[model samples]
Each structure stands twice: as structure tokens, then as C-alpha cells.
Target: MEEVRVKLPFNLAAGETEYRSGVWQGLVLKWQKEHLLLELPAEADSISSAVYGGGMGRLKRAVNQFVSRDYECSNPVRDMEAKLVEWGYPLEGCAGLMTAVPLEHAAVAEEDTGSAGIFCCVTAAAGNAARAGSQRSVLAAYRPGTINIMLAIDGWLSPSAMVNAVMTATEAKAAALADLGISDAENGLPATGTTTDAVVLAVSGSRRYAAEHVYAGTATDLGGAIGRLVYSTVTASLRSVKAAEAERK
Candidate 1:
């Protein structure tokens, strides 16, 4: 069967590439391995489920850098800290996410609506994919596979709206997995996502736009954009990984 390419509403940048969406510009770098660093035009209000700086807070000290690194280590926290030191980045001001999926398989999607813009980047590996709430006789040990999502917006989002966005993004991810027919190995149930999945959301909080989003549910425009961007990005990232695997075989 011929593979149908997923059409993104915006450009999809992959590998070592530089991209700009609205007020944000970022670099997809290849160090010892591939990683992505998105530098905001200014400090932005953000929320994350990352290991470093994994909470809702206003980014300070011009440390508006959001990073997604390809990592494989037993001591993730300590190794991630050392990686920042080796890269000359201060741990105090940056938000970081790690995944075993190589950055080469990373996918990016961007959308601009004149009033607000959204950007999403994803790295996905579903080897340990599982459905939420599945009954397991024994908990599995930590593994290297994960689905990491990094999202950015060029407009303002209320704190509550930020949390809403996270929910929306997560729902979209599960929907993508379902559509792909992914199943949990342990229970044979439809997989919702990998156990180690993580997400980071950042908003520019720019008043340059007249609208300030107070809600990011699926019913809202911001939420709609978030849903489409995340859904498409995750689907595309996973497809790319599958294609790579097929090519290797």
C-alpha cells in the first residue's frame, strides 16, 4: 500500500533545521545525537511535565529556552543536569524534556492565525505503549521509549487556560494512538500513550494581540488549533518512526 503523506496546516521541519513561527525561532541541533532547542523572543508563561523545571511558572532571567533532548540513561535527572552544564545552559531557567526517540525522527508543525500562532514538536516511540487504567500483575521497570511533546503559542493564555491546553493536547495524543490501532502489550487493549510521555506548553503572553485566551477547551479556537497541531504532529512522528523501521527491515 502506498503511504499517504499527512498534510500539515503549516510547514513540517525535520532533522537539523531552523524554523520560525510567529514570534518564535528555533534550532534543531545534532550534537552527540539530535535534540531541539526553541528560544522564545522573550520570557513566557509556561507549564511542563518535564524532569527539569517541570511546573507552571513564569520563566525568568531571559531563560525562555525550551529543550527536547534525545536521552538514554539510567540516571536521567543527574545526566540531564550534566548535559545542561556541558552545553553551558543554566539548569535554573530552562525547561527540558528527554526521550529515547532520536531527534532525527522528530516532527514539527506550525500554524499562524494572524491573531495567534501555535507551534508543536514531537518525538514519539511506542515500544512500551499501554492503555491507561489497564490491569497489570506487575509494574514494568522504566524503559527508554517515550512520547515527548513541546508546544508554544505566540499569544496570551490565562493560567487556567494553560492547564486546559495540556488536557486538550493529551486527549489528542490518545486519539492519535487509537487511530493508529496501537494496542497495549500487557492487556491487548487500545493504547492511549506511552507511560513515560511528557509535554511542555509555553505561551508568549504578548499583548500585541487583542485577544487573551481564558479557555482552551476543544470548543475554543485556541484549543482547536492545539488539538489539530498536536494530533497531526504525533501521528506524523509515529508514522515516520514506523517507516524508518520498515526501511531497516
Candidate 2:
């Protein structure tokens, strides 16, 4: 069973330059059964370009500190600033939404593989786009693409499923981009969507933050939510950018 009863959409902001520039930054804590786990975006698989890897690295370290230090940061704002600065992409304010997810079981689309848990958040930035498998030279210097999903699930997931999750999320994002005609002028891919878009995820042993925290639906529900949320949020961000550009024009 999944844990539907949750206290989520909580806020998590840290850094000298508030992590509140764009979307809301949140830190969701799901207290349930079993163990402890920490997840961050996969480098090279996400928006973690050579230039941005340091940020990811710092994020990982921060998450660890937040966790090992009892899963709470004394100063999250500084933590966020450190993470971003390490990646040389520090901004004035950044934000994210933290929420509890229902992933106690494998998604419904496929048969029951195993049980799982989820907590995820996303931030959108479609400033640039690049093709998959393209060389680093193609990426413009200083310009960062949009979209970064931070997903952390509890319990073990087959390695294949884990990889599939990233691709699936990317595909859904691409579909949303296509629907909105958000592609590049050169190759027609999403302007903000790059082959190297970032999807950070982590899986670990289950740990109960509270008592009796099981979700109601299967992991499929969670998957759908990720796609739906990403689509709407990213599209909205894209619109915001377009509107601003038009206004400037």
C-alpha cells in the first residue's frame, strides 16, 4: 500500500542568496517504515554539465549534511548558496516545492514489480535547448538550460526501472514541450529542453518518519503526477519567459 496521508508541499530554502528566485523551494519529510535514504540528480544524466557538476556535487554533500546532521539543516539558505556557488551558477534566489508522494508500489502501467515510496520536487528554466548525444562544444558558455527534477524514493527499485524512470520523465517533458511547440530553431528540439536535461533521483532503504505512512495508490499515480506537474509547471515557466521577452521586444 502507498502512503497517501502526508504533510507536504512544505518549503525548504537556504543560501545567502535565497533559493526563491523562481519556483518555491520545499523540503518534504515523509516519516514512515524501514530506513533512511538520500537522492540527488544523476550527473551527466541531468542538467549537470561539466560546469554544473560542482553544483550537483555540493547538493549531494548538503543533502548528506542535512541528513547525517539529523535530516535538518541549521541554515538551509547558506546550504543552497553553497551548492549553487560550487556549481558556479549561484543566483540571488531559488525555490522548490517539497511534497510527499505515493510510490509504495510499482506503477499500475506495469505489473507489480515491488513496493516503493516517493518524495519529489521540480524547478523549471527553459532558457536553452540542446540535442541528445551532442558534444559539449555545442553547449553555449554561461547559458544554462531549464528544468531540474529532484526525486527521492524509498526502497529498492530494479536498476532498469530506475533508468526507465528518468527516460520516462524526459519523454513526458518532451511531449509537453512538443504540445507547446517549445523547440529550438536549429534542430527543432525544445529550446529549454536539452538531451542532457537533469533528473536527479535517489533510492534507499525505507525509513518511517512517522507512524503508519502508506500511500493509497500505486507508483503509477506518482509517475503521472510527475509528468503532469512537470508539464504544467515547465510550460508555465516557458510562458513567463516568452511573455517577458515579448514585453522587452
Residue lDDT tens for model 1, 184-233: 98899999998778888878787777898999999988888788888888
What are the C-alpha RMSDs, in order, of all predicted structures? Answer: 5.0, 13.0
Tell me how far candidate 2 lies from the true structure as C-alpha RMSD in angstroms.
Answer: 13.0
Candidate 1 residue 90 Cα shift, in angstroms, is 2.0
Error of 1 at 54 (Å): 0.6
The TM-score values for the models, in the order shown, are: 0.83, 0.46
CA lDDT, every model vs. true structure:
0.71, 0.38
lDDT against true structure, model 2: 0.38
In candidate 1 the C-alpha lDDT for residue 23 amounts to 34
lDDT score for residue 136 of model 2: 36
Q: Clashes in model 1: which pairs?
A: none
Indicate the worst ten consecutive residues by lDDT in candidate 2: 102-111
